[model samples]
Target: MKKIYCLIYILFTLPLLSQEKEGITHSGQLTGNPPFPIENYSELDNPKSTSETLWNKKNRTFVSWANTDVRYNKEIPAPIALSQETLHLSAWKGEQLNAQLIISAHRKSLELNFEISDLSSSQSKIESKNITGGFVRYVMTDELNKDGKGACGPRNHKEFDSTLVADPIDHLNDRLSIAKNTTRPVWVTINVPRDITKGKYTGEIKIRDGDRILKKLGLEIEVLDRVLPKSENWKFHLDLWQNPYAAARYYRTDLWSDEHFAAMKQDLQHYVNAGGKSITASIMNRPWNGQTYDPFQSMVTWRKTIDNKWSFDFTVFDKWVEFMMDLGVKKQINCYSMVPWRLAFEYFDEASNSMKTIETKPGEKAYSEMWGAMLKAFATHLKKKGWFGKTYISMDERPMDVMLETIKLIKSADKNFKISFAGSFHKELLERIDDYCLALGENYPQEILGKRQNRGKISTFYTSCAHPRPNSFTFSPPAETAWYGWYAAATGLDGYLRWAYASWPLEPLLDSRFSTWAAGDTYLVYPGGRTSIRFQKLLEGIQAYEKIKLLRREFIESGEKEDLKKLDTLLNGFASSEIIEKDVAQSIKKANIQLNSF
Candidate 1:
């Protein structure tokens, strides 16, 4: 592809080149976005010949919300153009909200500094520490034109591009080195303290260039009388499968070494902060048959004695479980695969004195004998460690026959063992599975959900290469993550599930294209525990869920039927799949207006 210039736009703004001294502007964002450039500058603005400058500068706009990718060497995206003015925000105590302040080096490379002031209310004040920000860095990303049917296949899919086309907000930095005609974005975060007084607090964010202020936007936060419980207290059953192998590979550390755990901790902190409630554990090698760049090795090692007796080693498994528990993802431990993509199982052959692999199906004698011995031992170990109740034997998108055989095998071994499933809805297994997650667009029977709730079972939903809009694809709109909460509310689901969390590619922070799945599809947060715009917005969505949950309960307690009914009606619109097909940010914003009014 070639860089396309806005010839007519340049012609219209060339005469007004001298007005730049009045305000600061830059360009970024992407195509497929509305073209609403409100500010333009020319080379006449070049006071710094020290850096590269263009004869014609790209256009930039002041936007009310940023939901598109910010691209360099690509056409700028049209923003919901707004004049520089106060950005009003509302949040409950302990809630975190995010926004962007973009400053591209339109005329020349520039240096930028940031300062956020302390906001004051009549009863109290919010410290400057509550408001924090960092420069947003661009990372390369591939795009998927189609869903690819959610296949666990190799790379080089014709429907997806191997080349990087989009650069979404994937990194946060304290400093940036911008080049000519390129852009840099500042990610601003406002963390309302749980104990802050219920009143309006006022402040401003000042962006400086050299010694002079480049731009200043007023920040007014309305701290609600209500409080959003801490992430630890959240009820959302967020399950993002972790890949320890990826962390070990990314950091060049030995598997399960101290260095590896340290490196993994950095990334898992991002997960814990999002109110993560589950830990992914693989009981067999290559659980998904190498779908990801990294191979997921089983924590429990299988061994056989010369006498033909089976034994299991829980050293790695125990360490992993304790590690995640220590980090606060202690609610559930999801063990992968009574049935993997492939039926090949591996074990140490004591008689042969070598490692061996066996191919077997669930019902056959070989498969049952091997898995039965392991589960018997696994249950005993879990009971000894006090993890028996929370541990679940989890399976992915397998066929109905396979699932039935596998579930039978599990129960025959020990009916007390729990099971977690993520796939198409099967009414036959609804009473059997403990934690059931349906895929996007796959409806779960609303009436059945009540029975599951009564029985203390979980019913959530997920998205993969199959769902396009309202997904966390790197090129997807940032608001889509938040739209997820609205979807959950509309459907009355517990939470969301994603197959990959930190299943990093060869180079995640730079190029997010993987050979198998969609680009950036294998991960949410970046390496080194950095949070992306998508991940941040995902937290935003979870927070939105928590807030909405609390508000609904409050309304019910206070008998505010009108407000509660209006809120329910607003959420009902999301029940239709058509909401994601449209611009969700507009819908969410309108809904928020009514929510804040009460």
Candidate 2:
């Protein structure tokens, strides 16, 4: 009996000894064998945690401590607080996932360096491409203008107010100093390669201040056998208007120069990597005036010969096309402005050795003739360059009469021309356009939209200053940006379009506010480097949409109408509400779960 008692004591003590060896204390503290003194650290899924170890070991642990609630009130436009929890990220094979963690510095300014452990075993490990850092971005916000116009109406050229009167707000940066008692968001992205092996990979992200380990956050990625297709397979026709001229202005360089080209290439590559499909091409000067960037010159130039014959110079235009093609913008080259802002066109006149303008005030004979000839020349060039089929003559926020007139002129030039417009949804205009990007709140007959979509017409919706909800801007929540994709799937729309991609303010990275438009209106991306949180959220939304599309296809192939109905129900419900990030993630998770079961 004494011997048996000794055995029981040994068994219990042995386990305790093992726990101690692993740096786990009887008080449940993880004092993992580090040189420095580490204490007062707790893990939470959110900032408002009452206890440590809020989840299972397999789950991600967000580290945070109890603190006073940080609110965004009127007194403080940009208040910073510590993140309530650490960040957790999960991704499938061939998918990229990102998460933001809030870090607060309470006493004084602090700088923290972070490194991740190798998530590998003897057989397999996550590739360097699969794990990367320094992709951090700051989160900024502005007060919503309550008195602003609600939705963009017909020919509504007026600006939508964001009411951002204060200086621009941004979370403290990781590379830069974090102010005392200030909070900031740090973003980390993980890309699971398409050919990665299936299994659970575990690692730790250690936050350090010099030689001291401030915190060791855990990371886990579950790589499945499933492969996410390329961004091109995402059926949505996403068009974020590009501003190469913005690149030049921001960088203080001449257009198409080595410096300007490099900057523009960076911005364009960022857009394409984030699932932007439609490329905006300027065929005339100042396609949309009074906008973010300066009036861009027409890529195509025309000259009258010494003998009074008309000639075209395709040098600059050809270079632009080649550059776009090199960047893999073969999906859709959307030519800006068959009828641009204020119905004006400008061109360089080599014969006169000067630049000239043609204004299309009603019944302006010179304007009509000049525009007609220009359209004819553009159509012929597009056809000869093999860009006609993938090209669309685009206009923005113009009146019905103007759009119709522009379409007529283009069609007369080339009968097979495809026209794309972002205007108020007009029933009569639905059948006339190959691509109609309507505002969200426009009174449109669903039957017409459905019918147009059925006939292979590309139907999309756009949001700007007027239609602020469900927007990809700093003021809006990241989840709302992601919901655009799910919303498109539910509504049976082809895709989404935002007016600006790189239209920067005077100091875009510092402040996204614009004088004429809403804050964060001029651009989705910053000037010199890195993408915005809104942009990343947009990518997530696109990924979610693509996942849903693939699952729906599988369900159809497998004849699982019930599963398909369930997914549709979830998506429709999400679409109808002011969606949160959790709901979007849950919906995607549930849909994937259902898909995997098949």
Candidate 3:
């Protein structure tokens, strides 16, 4: 009888012991002050006590080291007893690399600060400015989503648990307190210079409380002999759809204000750093009918004059594209979308003196005339800005029957116009579309990809609500993020796309859940330009893609058939349906081991 009571007590007390700052959501800024105006989202802290683990053991307060792939929740005891571990890494020149370390305070609260030393290669040194540190912040994942479309288990992943899940990598500087028996993660980011000498680099990440040192982890990296092209030059296309309105709303600034642009620039710079290749500009209002928290208002205002002529205000569209290009995402402007989920066309009515929405579907005369004029005008404006060559008229998940008519309408508007679509496989529209994206698990026929490759067209895949694994959902395993790059390479894809870049919730820093999607599905990075662990791990995968591309080319040019076969085999291993947890975890592990050897 006594044993049973003791067991029950331990079960209930373990989770409570870890969240010292459990209910506190005030600090949202990277400054570590207020997270947002709403001090608390009742759901930020679970209303009901939830179990982090089935069983655990009590231990003394201690610090430890953990890899970036590991997601340590605040509600459970640190899984490992590792007090220190070396951060072994490799990067191509001009690439930004990141790693994570854990500081566990078991059954004891702690106020901690941190610092990172400069990385030096015997030849040259990387300054502290290039290497930055941040502490990972925790947000509540109150419920595991069973997405309406479909999803696998809401199983044991902490990001899916209804507890305090550490995710956002906060801006370093402010001292933070760790809850008793909880873990705090310190993130170290390194920006390798393009011109730096190629060799070994070593550094130390010092964990401290004020002037006292708690631990120092050894950091080592081999700047590979091969130089990776700068982000702007990388061929692996990355398109993370952007939502500018959310930044303004979360930061409490006026839309398009100087403050808003300043706030947005920070996050956008991070995107560019990750090799973002496309500018996601909306051409039609509510492109997906309020799928996001903020309205993706039409960048170009469409109006029918009293004289029955069509005119467009490209002021917003031009400013956005120019701003993004100036920031280095200059490859393609993917303007979404011509075939919106709902065929509700919004335009300024000169006769009514108001914005009006016309409900019309594709193939209808009204729809044809309305879009035809807009596309023609849009083409003219794009040509004026010298953007016509790189601009793609993009759409997301509309039916094939509709696509045929829309494609016909688009080509009729302007023969040179390029069209992009990301959704289910569409064989009929293949010849007509320039940039094509299919959902994960959907393969593009070899012959189709071959032809497109010769034509300088792009063939890629995307993961959205339907894909159960290898997805970027907040609670997804960190290994899944890296899997995207490996999978793309294995399948001979040009690149990948994640539509949710910053479709943030009310207080993104505090909560990452939504009514319909899994936690963290709505956004990747937090406000104030802070990147999440998920985002950093994603960088790990993309860097892998670039490395593979570089190595494959070098091997072929140098006639290294043996190495080429080895590389090809490794990538081919990732070609499997990587939706299973154990298989993906093992594949990522195996690929990383073999990649570093090369």
Candidate 4:
């Protein structure tokens, strides 16, 4: 009896021990002192938390790496400034022994201060290796603004934030902010605990004046038993190709339209037939001045009304969308970024030697506001047409203030209209609304690459899809490519978005004319009459893999190891070394057989 009891005890305890060892969680909050009005304090934290605090005294002046007082210069930009005057607190977990925040910005005059909350109050338990002493700021003054007043900190046009959990290789850039001031290029770094967990953490940094407290940022940590899933599901976003340059070059050409709207309808129908859902069509005005009609050398303009409303000429855009729906291209449409460009001046002439900005009348809302109204108008129009719950509205890369106002406008006009944007913007926006978004794939490759369930539909990136040669493809292993789709499916990605699918012919048009270039290899269209053939094969393969995924999911749910092994074996069989590793001299023989089967 004693021996049997010991075996049972050992069997039951091992798994629990392993789970505990692997478990890890992290979280933080931003908070500061009272006095200044915290217009939207809640924007500083995650909105999904049940016990969320609304904008309050603790969030008074919202300042940070975004708004600074420094003069704008090409080399250094201003510090992130806030309108408040109080200190704050924040918290985090070190997790493992290898974690660090690399802060590199322009300006050294800025400073940092950190404090760890010892929830346990045990001095002996404090970790020494986990703390980084000070923050380092970079200052460059060579490039100043046209006014020569501030540093323009070289525009790191490549802007995006990558989380620690994402794929490292895919992250092409770091979380470095551009300084618009030459005198203040302060970048700070903080060493974090290697394995700290379940504690209160706080920190404070002051701008030059020091009287106003930057946004009080604080985070409380409670290492939970299980971490929540990163996202709800894959979201699909389909938008009409609003770029006239692209539309004229591809869809609107004499060859394409002259033959058939058949191809266009077919593409849409096929996508829907393959379980694809959702589309985003824009109502952006013509890229050129309506009068001049020139493709290049144009600017954006805005118009607004007394009731705080806006309008646009959507006849052309409406025609395209109506054609799709009329042809039974079944998909929900998300009216994305209603205002896409700043229109050129009405009086401007294409024949003219120069152009200038059109000044708006006093008290008139800016171009962005007019754009927001357009979004509301479109949503209202769709609702009246019985597409209320079937549609959504979104804004991208706007200020937090504008986002909140827009959300209010959208909701006021139609309560059911879904609102969202790209997730690469301000954190405050994430805290303020239930807005959903598509993560920019190209913006943060590291976050998605190789990470399971890391990507989904509606993401954007520049990929070398199916072209050949050194410049035609990314040259990534099949497994690496496969992982993107596989992980996207696992993560519930709505749909994958690329610049083009079948642009046709493998000729050199962009980079290496006549010769091949990898950058231009994303097109799905092959040269011969067999364009769709190659595309069909790739699609079919993807569907087959999707089936395998379903089978694997079932196996996991059922805990059937043998079933999983069988699926793995079948997968391996398809790409076995025996089939792929043939010598090139004789491999043509096998290659012919394999290609024929596909």
Highest TM-score model number: 3
Tens digits of per-residue lDDT for model 4 on 42-62?
112112222112222132222
How many residue pairs clash per model?
Answer: 2, 3, 5, 81
Off by over 4 Å in 4: 1-263, 266-276, 286-314, 326-328, 338-364, 394-409, 412-415, 423-483, 490-495, 502-518, 526-541, 556-598
Q: Ranking under TM-score, best-scoring first?
A: 3, 1, 2, 4
Which pairs clash in the backbone of model 3?
A: 26-35, 27-35, 28-34, 28-35, 107-181
* lDDT for predicted candidate 1 compared with the true structure: 0.72
Residues 38-105 of candidate 2: C-alpha lDDT, one tens digit per residue:
12111111212222222221122123421111122121112224433333445667788764444444
Candidate 3 residue lDDT tens string, 485-575: 8888888899988878998864577767554456677788877778888888888788889889988998999999999999998987888
Shift of residue 229 alpha carbon in model 4, Å: 27
lDDT of 4 at 479: 28
Alpha carbon lDDT of residue 197, candidate 2?
81
Candidate 2: TM-score? Answer: 0.79
lDDT of 3 at 539: 81
TM-score of each: 0.86, 0.79, 0.88, 0.39
Cα miss at 134, model 2 (Å)?
Answer: 3.4
What lDDT does candidate 2 reach at residue 152? 23
The numbered model that scores best in lDDT is: 3
